[model samples]
Target: MEAGDIATWVGVLITLGISVATYVQSRRQARIADEANIASQEQVEAAQRRAVAVEDSLAEALRLLAERGLTEAPPTPAMSGGPGAVRWNLERRGKHSYLLRNVGTATATGVHVDRNRATPIVRNMPENATVRPGESLQFLMAPTFGNPLPGEVWVVWEGQPEAISVPLP
Candidate 1:
């Protein structure tokens, strides 16, 4: 073959290689763009899920506050030390007394009281007791062992999903 013909064939081969390389590069770029788009969509979906969770949490918190306002007592101390003197004592030495007075408008039914975050004690409230408005219930805690720890009261009443917590003095 002639020198000119050989040179022309080499030029054609180089042109074909260049075209192939360009096509491969374009395909890679398209794949990269598709991956980026998928990642962006996943991020958006995650953010939407988080927002929905936050909204649900806020709704539950509002409902709990409303329930407490309707049902929980206003911590009215009953009169102690005979019938004439009006006094309320939560704790006195080894004897611990909790006084729960229902000052809300609604009556609390099936009231149960217990302590929380302390050594396991089997003391519970009276069975099937109901507290009307302006009425009160009393619970006593006497630790047989070590000194009493500052504890909280868990009050469960009827028609309420969560318990009402009262910290004792």
Candidate 2:
């Protein structure tokens, strides 16, 4: 091959290398952008979930303040697990009590899990003790474990799906 021909071939190889490098860089940037979009979508979904939870809590608070006569006395200190998932919070308003009985015709309930997450309270509740839908035996309010919880407290109660907190305090 002639010297001029060799020089021309070298120039062509350099241009091809530059083109391949540019393509690789562009592909890498595209992948990075895609990953960023996915992360942003997940964050949005999490925010939406938190917003819903807050809305439900607000609705419950409203219900507590609106009702007057329905809730004569406070209910039992509802027990639950985990950090955020609380069935009831009577820490500030003092200890609470409950005497739940089935109103429905032989509907199964009281099947609860133990501390180790086992089904220990399988049908723990007694038979139909005749607590009507609008009737409760003795949803009393007692003191806490040791202390008389004073001051303005922030107690949160989360009931079942079909249940709403009555006589909001």
Error of 2 at 19 (Å): 0.8
* Tens digit of per-residue lDDT, candidate 2, span 1-169: 9999999999999999999999999999999968966775665456446645755775686577557545543332222232322232111122343333333332122212121221222122122222223222222333344544222222112233332222223
TM-score of each: 0.40, 0.40
* Model 1 TM-score, all chains together: 0.40
Q: Name model 2 segments beyond 4 Å from true.
A: 68-169
Candidate 1 residue pairs in clash (backbone atoms < 3 Å): none
Model 1 worst lDDT window (10 residues): 79-88
The runs of at least 3 residues in candidate 1 whose Cα sits more than 4 Å from the true structure, single-residue gaps closed, are 70-169
lDDT of each: 0.56, 0.39
Model 1: per-residue lDDT, tens digit, 42-74? 654564466457557756876777787866433
